[model samples]
Each structure stands twice: as structure tokens, then as C-alpha cells.
Target: MFAGDQNGLQGDPRLKAISEAIRVVPHFPKPGIMFQDITTLLLDHKAFKDAVDIFVDRYRDMDISVVAGVEARGFMFGPSIALAIGAKFVPLRKPRKLPGEVISEAYVLEYGTDCLEMHVGAVQPGERALVIDDLVATGGTLCAAIRLLERVGAQVVECACVVGLREVKGQHRLNGKPLYILVEPRQLTNCSAPSVTIITRRDQLSYYSQDSEN
Candidate 1:
């Protein structure tokens, strides 16, 4: 999707629509956090469809066999992309969320430690996989998803997220997995409202302070 790179994406019209559709809800889930709410984006059928279609068009010919979505928000984009690309959808869920026997991998989040679980036989060795998530704040969740797939012997071709946010300096690299992010938000602070420097993807909304204030 990012054929020419970030600079090229800066000019791409598809991403612009997605970006506009994403609303920055100030102090959501807590104070001082400006959350990028994707639910609104999901509601805009044209924008939502464009977001999914962009991903489908990119991976359609990439020989992707498995689409592993990090639980919750990843579920939103993952299944759509998987169906379009002719890949099976695998959910990497929160602890105890999966009914069957599962394997787990732990990772650190901006707040605390958490883990992701996948069904034992959900994926096969050597199958090409793509991990999708709604946001990549610290990259912990996505990394865990990638490791979980790798542990099961599946080859993860890349990790894809709706947002590519670089808050910490050079902290989001897990085994150098390639990340394909659809939108990198342009931080818009109100200057009048309190601002924080962190954003977490809670599937719903977590807060960070990059906003377009009126």
C-alpha cells in the first residue's frame, strides 16, 4: 500500500480520508489522553471500506495464507482483509478468551504486562501469515502475536496496523518484523487543552494528546 514510502503516503488520497474519519477524542478512558477513535471511522462505510480495501489490494497477491488478528480491534480489519485475500482468519485473543487449548506469549504494554493466546491448532507451520492490529503504540501486542505465530511454526510475512505511531524513540522493533501501517496521524494539539504524550489502543479508546482542536 505504501508503495512510494511515508512521504508518498503523505500525498496519497486514500489515507487522507481514513485520517479524517478518525476522530481524536480528548481525555478518553482517562484524563490527559487524546484517543484516536476508530469507531467513527468504522461507521463511515466509504472510509471503512477504503481502509479495508487498501489492505486487501496490497495483500491480495502476496500469497498470504493466514490472517492473524490481535484480539478486539484487529478483529475489525482482519476478517475483512482475510476474506478478500482468501486467507483464513485467526484470532489472537486475550487470556482465557479462547475456549480450546491455546499457546500464550507475553509482552509489555505502555501500562503493564499482558499476553495473547491463540488456539493450539489454529495455524500450521510454514504457512504465510499477516498480523493485523488497529494501533501500534508500543508494538508489544503485535510483537506477541508475531512470536505466537512463529512459535507455532507459521512464517509471519509482516505486521499490519491501522495506525503507525512513533511516540518513544526507536522502541517498537521486534525481531525487525516489517510493519505496514495505513495511517500515521499528524499530531494536532489544541494548545489550550491539556496534552499528554502517549496513546494506547484499547480497541475502544485509550488517550494520548495529539488532537485537532477547535
Candidate 2:
């Protein structure tokens, strides 16, 4: 389950395989909630590496100075990608998680509302930044992430995620910032099903969020 020392993988086939490796838990965190679980994908070494490689390859030479990952889930691949690109890893965490003086931005979620925090000086002015998350449902978290970075004068290059559930509210939420997704399983009403759309851009990823971001 570990793609320990190999990378440089490209194309949809590898991404599709990585998407397939992600497990979906029905009614998780709440009834009628189909929680997309990346822990399963994390177990697959090659899949995890491929995911990180995809982001690393794209940003390695983009002069991206900072890689900011959303709390919890985003922590999984953020550091690795930052390391590959020779950038610093910044964690945007939940309230009070950071011990230093921090700034916060509030956002709504598919389920509720929450805030994201970052250290006061994690990013400097004119620094190119990239935001990473495991999945984007309503995009509230990503939106807040972008705002947090911009407030500090960072140029948010793009927001990347493993999956995106299409939600109309997500549009204009980033104000033209590109949101890239590795995959969006359009159909697979459950984890047991076998259909997913491998997406590389927001236009395609929006196809999955018609009903709800979940």
C-alpha cells in the first residue's frame, strides 16, 4: 500500500486508480452523509505518492514559495508536496490549534460553519501560495483558506484537492482562482460502486455537485 520511492506518474489512469483507492463511508459523521474517506487511499503507497507527485510536479518550478494546507486532512500530503518543491509547509488549522499569534477566517461548510487559522507570519507579501485539501464539498474551507492567504498579501496560485463535489455556491467563491481536483466519482452512490470521473479542472469537477457537496 506504499508507493515508497517511486514517482513521476502522470495521466488519468494513475489518477483514476488513486481515486478508486479512496473509500466512501455511508452515513458517516451523520445520517445520509456519504463521507469520502482518504484514509484508505493513504494506505496505498503508490496512490498516495501519485497524488503528491501530481501536485509536486505542477508546482515544482512555478516559483511557489509557500504551500498552505487545510487542517487535519490537508496535512496528509501538504508537507511532502512542499518538500518536493523546496517550499515551506504552512498548516491552516482549526481554531486554537496553533500556539502562536494567529489570524482567522470564517467559512460555511456543507454541514455547518467553521473557521480556519494560520500563524501571523506564516506567509509573506508577494509569496505565491497553493492550497491543498483532501476533498472540497461546499468549498467553504477552501474559500476561507484563500481569504486567509490573500489577507496577508500572498498570491494564491491555485487550490488543489483529491475530490470535488459540485456545488453552485462554489462558483465565484474563489473569485477566479482555479480549483483543481484529481477525481470526482459522478455516480457511485456508495463506496461499493465503481464509477468516478477523473477530473483535472473545476469545470469537470463541478459536474459532481449538482445535488449536494457531500
Candidate 3:
């Protein structure tokens, strides 16, 4: 699972552990779908710590002022990363979810229209920021988050995710900005960006099959 996280250049046991925590279920929330259930990993302490540590270590050099996590799931690890880096945690939420005067950006999801909001002036001008999400399939959520953060004058240093699903076709929205992930679908089955490869097994041979085949 560290295949993508290592930029396809390295591997690690922690990555393998993180991958096993993610479950794959066929036809979830709808038909013809495979959802990466992160709850398995999220529930485990060591797995969650490893996942967060990867990001924390990756962005350690950057002078990150805030770590923004989107919604419910993002909230899980975002705050931990922020705490590790000694930065403030910002929450990106749906419309009206926040009580303050928030700036909002809307984007399309595979299922329906979605929106993300941040309080006005949550980030100061020229502030270095990093956005994290559990996963990125279409890049819609990440793009919307970048827009909302940039709207207030934050420099998006990078974007990261535990998994990326390279089938939805949305990486272009990042505009060449740095994107990091732990794993991608074993096969390039489709032209999807922000692809996420979830691993439910611990066997090294199966998880690294893609690298071996190449």
C-alpha cells in the first residue's frame, strides 16, 4: 500500500498495515460500485497512527500553519496531523454545517452536487496550508477545498490522501500541485485521477503485484 505513498519508489511495513485496514466492498451505497471502507483502519490505533505519521513526516519540512480536513472522515486524521505538526486544524464542511459566516464552494460528486465551506479569514494571506482527505476519487472535493482556501489567500503547498482512485478523471484540477497517496488501484482500469487502492489483505506478494508485474 505504500506503493503510491512512496511515489512507487519504495515500500514499508507501515504502508502494508495501513492498506490492510482499508476494506473493499462490491456494490456499496449503489450497484456497480466498490467502496473503500476506511473504518477498519480508522478503528485501529496503530493503523491510524501510521497513516497520520506518513503525512506528518512528508510535510514536516513545510511551514504549514493549518491542516484542513474535509467533513466527518477527514476530521478523524486531520486534527491528529495538525497536532503532530503543532498547527491549527481547519474543518471544511457542507453548506450551513458551520455556524460562522463561511465562504462556500460547490463541486460535483459522482453521486450528486457537493459543497465545502470555510469561515471567512480562517487562513491569513500567504499562509502555507495543506489539505488532507481520506480519499480522492474525482478531485472535486480537493479542488473545491483549494479554491476555498485560496479565496482567503492561503498557498496550497500540497494535497494528500490515504488512497487515490485513478478512475474518475479529475487530477488535472490540481494544476500540477503536489499530490500524494499510499496506493492506487492495482490496474489502471480507467482514466480516473485521485484514485485510491484499498488493501484488505496483508500478504506482500498480492499487495505489491502491480509493482512486480511492471
Candidate 4:
């Protein structure tokens, strides 16, 4: 069991199962990028179930009323957790994808800005929400999703992901909201293979900023 300053995950066998199931593709969509592919993980039923079970076990007791999944991948884990925890599943979609009075939030990416949209009446004031995503790279997408939920008065309980890239430093932009993740950043090496590391709490978000000042 890995421990950190915050709430820790104990004796979780699902972590290893998930890590082994991911397939890493080299230079996908660009050069010098290792893409962590979950589709391969999805193909393995036991691995996929283990991944969802880890999240469901953690959030099942929490009073999360809505599970908001980001555009594509989040749709996979969000619905399962939502159903397990007895919450409604809401889709945080891409631009112009949702119809009928949608609310949108724009966030900065390493290259530029992109927008995420949600239906206007999807969340009500004071409702509790949990944001789900496959991975946290630069955090722009998740940040945008959080803003969209908060803009309409929903309280975002936390952001959850299967993997987090510490080198990318997107966790810094989460605005102090707790991010629960199964795999830590250090475990993912530069090699062209998918991997997973032990879980840990992200206590600070200004790691990149502090490095840049030096």
C-alpha cells in the first residue's frame, strides 16, 4: 500500500492490473510524445473492471450527486461510478456538441486555448459533483470542466483520474481541489511503454512555476 500526506489507498491490487493493461504508443499525433492508451485496457474486461472498481470503492461513500465525465474517455468511467454510487451521469462535451442552452468554459493548453461545453440545466446550485477523466496531462481539459460545473453553482467535490503526468504539471491549475489518482507520475518512464506507479497525494500545484523562476 502506498501512503501520502492525504487520504491513502490501501492494499489495492487493482493498480497493478490497470498498469499492465495500458498500451503505450510512441509519437502518436506528434513526435516525442508517448500516448497512454486505455482502449487496450478496455479490451481486457478484468482490467477494466479493476480500474472502475478502484474509483467506485473510493467514491461510493461520498455524497456525490452527479458524476461529470469529460468529452470522450471520461464517458467510460463516469457512468459506471455514477451508477454504482447512485448519482446522475452528466456529460461535459466539446464545443457545439451539446444542444439547448449550453454553458461553456475555455482553458489554456500548452499550444492554445480550447473550450468545453455542458448543458445549461445539467447541474443545479449547491449540487455536489465529481469530475472524471482518463488522465491528467496539462489539466486544461479538467480545469475547464471544473469551471463549467462551478459556473452554474455546483460544488465540485474532487477531480479523479486513472493516471497523472507530473512532468506536464497540469495538476497545478486545479485551484486547490483534491485530485484522486490511481497512478503517480514518476512511474511513467520516457520509454515507449505504458506503465503505472504508486499513488500519492498532490499537495502543491506550483511545481512548474517554482522551477521556471530558478
Give the number of the best model, judged by TM-score.
1
In model 4, what is the error at residue 57, expressed in angstroms?
1.1
Candidate with more favorable, higher lDDT: 1 or 4: 1
Shift in Å, residue 178, candidate 2: 0.5
Worst 10 residues of 1 by lDDT: 205-214
Candidate 3 residue runs with Cα over 4 Å from true position: 5-9, 185-214
lDDT of 4 by residue, 43-142 (tens): 9999899878878888888899999998788998999999999999999987899879998898764446677899889899999999999877667678
Q: For residues 1-214, what per-residue lDDT tens digits would candidate 2 score against the true structure?
A: 1121222333456777787788765534434334567889999999999888888877898999899988788899899999999999999998989997999998764335678899998899999999998876556668899999999999999988877655333535786888777765334553542233222222212223234433
Per residue, candidate 1 scores C-alpha lDDT tens digits across 77-173 of 9999999999999999989899979999987755577889999999999999999888776566777888899998999998887776654322256
Q: Relative to the true structure, how large is the alpha-carbon lDDT of every model?
A: 0.76, 0.73, 0.71, 0.73
RMSD of 4: 5.6
For all predicted structures, in order, the TM-scores are 0.87, 0.81, 0.82, 0.83
lDDT score of residue 65 within candidate 2: 89
Clashing pairs in 2: 1-44, 1-45, 2-45, 3-45, 3-46, 166-209, 185-196
Once superposed on the true structure, which residue ranges of model 4 sit more than 4 Å away at CA? 1-7, 185-214
When sorted by lDDT, best at the front, the candidate numbers are: 1, 4, 2, 3
Give me the overall lDDT of model 4.
0.73
Models sorted by TM-score, best on top:
1, 4, 3, 2
Residue-by-residue lDDT tens digits, candidate 3, 92-205: 988898997888898765446778899887888899999988776557678888988988989998888787755444466776677788865432345232232322211111
Candidate 1 overall Cα lDDT vs. reference? 0.76
